[model samples]
Target chain A: SQQGEEDPQALSIQEGENATMNCSYKTSINNLQWYRQNSGRGLVHLILIRSNEREKHSGRLRVTLDTSKKSSSLLITASRAADTASYFCARTSGTYKYIFGTGTRLKVLA
Target chain B: EPEVTQTPSHQVTQMGQEVILRCVPISNHLYFYWYRQILGQKVEFLVSFYNNEISEKSEIFDDQFSVERPDGSNFTLKIRSTKLEDSAMYFCASSEQALLGEKLFFGSGTQLSVL
Candidate 1:
């Protein structure tokens, strides 16, 4: 079974607008990480938030984690067409394995 | 910056044939992992290797699947018999164990097409 599942399988926004995607997981995790994938490519690590941390940011990417709710959200501010890609949330279980969500496809229109 | 690298960016094999996918992890990393993603599906963990042995593996890694670090730099995943359902993008990742929070760096991936 999948441990995490992302909401709104897909999202589209104009450049400069913000894009928000949510993910919900089923099990307790030590940490959560978000990744981006261009079409037909490998994943690129974006941000990671430990269970103890409520929020984290890197450049235009911001991630928030609410362990109580078993959910997390990733926000990309001032989106650009180059930012168009598929986003995935990966939850690290105690077993040292990461289970990834089905992912949300984001398209930033210029 | 160091990066994980995989060979034969794409591979094609016939059903029942053997296939080997290779990966070269970052020189300083101590942990190696393999993941696969079927088209339109989530990335799935197949196996993790440490100290020349498998640390963990998922059910998807059946008897037919095997992993080996033949030398210091090359990690290989071998499938005894290919199946059409096995076609997917295989990614290799590595991380430093000494680092408190291990952040995996992944390779570009090898697209395997089983026909």
Candidate 2:
């Protein structure tokens, strides 16, 4: 079964605007990681937030984890046309398996 | 930077036939994994391996699936008997350590088309 579900199956924004994607999970997780996948390609790890950490940042990527709510969010600041891709949240639960969400397709217009 | 690599970017096979997908994980990484994504669907975890053995697997990983680390650098997933439903993009990933929050390096993936 999938552990996480992402909201807003699709989003479109102009370059320089911020894009926010939300993820909700069912079970207790050790960590949650966000990934981006271009069409016809594999996923690229963007950022990872541990259960113990509330928020983390890397370049334009900001990930926040709220263990109390069993949810996480990924915010891409000043999005660029190159950032357009499918965003997915993967949760690592008690098992080693990392369950992925349905994903959000983000399209940034040039 | 070392990255995961997969072979046969695209493969076409007939149902009931066997197929093998190969991957080479990042150097010095200790953990490896295989995932599949159907068209317009979420990526699904198939299996995770550590220390040359499967550490975990999802229900989608049935008897038809098998993973092996035949050599020091190569990891492979074999489908004993392919089915049309098995057609999807198969991705291989690897992590440097077993930490809970480490990032996974993924390969470009192989598009498996089981006709």
Candidate 3:
């Protein structure tokens, strides 16, 4: 699968700390999104940033996209135990084919 | 909040057998998609369906795999002859619009194990 790659395949943080993960794709994208998946569960959409937008925020989650570099980063501020899950960055252009990046597995200790 | 729902949370089948994973997307969603993830692997797109026809499919979606929206609400992915490699977590997702940009709401997924 020639998809995207995420850095720090895994991360561990304590509650109240911040966790960040980066994603890079090979193709052009019109929009990108972040998704969270609990262990053995379905993925839930978190946030999305368009190609023109540099940053987007939703509550404690912040996402930044760099079109020039074809990469994006997700930041979870004041991480909590409930925020412990795998995060994936998905990219899509003007087509139905959406590609997902390798995910970052975060373990938040209480 | 509306949610996409998949049936038979888990399935165990023998090789060469046929299996159909079903999903019922949110009533108003217009676009549907199928994705699979092998253990410890990233999610891979299989097929995208809209207006009762396939819009796009990945290389992984070969001849043995087919998708259909039998009625107004049920979408299914059928594997004619299941292979051992087909063992993975198959997820059904739907977006309100395939208008090129929209977030997907995925089902809990059906864990298929081909023995």
Separate DockQ for every predicted complex: 0.62, 0.78, 0.82
Q: For model 3, how does the per-residue alpha-carbon lDDT over B1-115 read when each residue is reduced to its tens digit?
A: 9999999899999999999999999999999999999895699999999999999999999999999999998999999999999999999999997577788999999999999
Q: Which stretches of candidate 2 lie over 4 Å from their true place?
A: none
Q: Give me the displacement of residue A47 in model 2, in angstroms.
A: 1.0
Name the better of 2 and 3 by lDDT. 3
The positional error of residue B47 in candidate 3, measured at the CA in angstroms, is 0.3
Give residue B63's lDDT in candidate 3 (0 to 100).
98
lDDT winner, 1 or 2: 2
CAPRI quality band, candidate 1: medium
Residue-wise lDDT of candidate 1 within A19-68, one digit each (tens)? 99999998888889999999888788898999999999999999999999
Best by TM-score: 3
Compute the interface RMSD for each candidate structure. 1.8, 1.1, 0.9
Worst 10 residues of 1 chain B by lDDT: B95-104
TM-score of 2: 0.96
Name every residue pair that clashes in candidate 2: none
- Model 1: CA > 4 A from native: B98-101
Candidate 2 chain A, run of 10 with poorest lDDT = A1-10
TM-score of chain A of 2: 0.96
TM per candidate = 0.97, 0.96, 0.98
Q: Tell me model 3's lDDT, rounded to 2 decimals.
A: 0.93
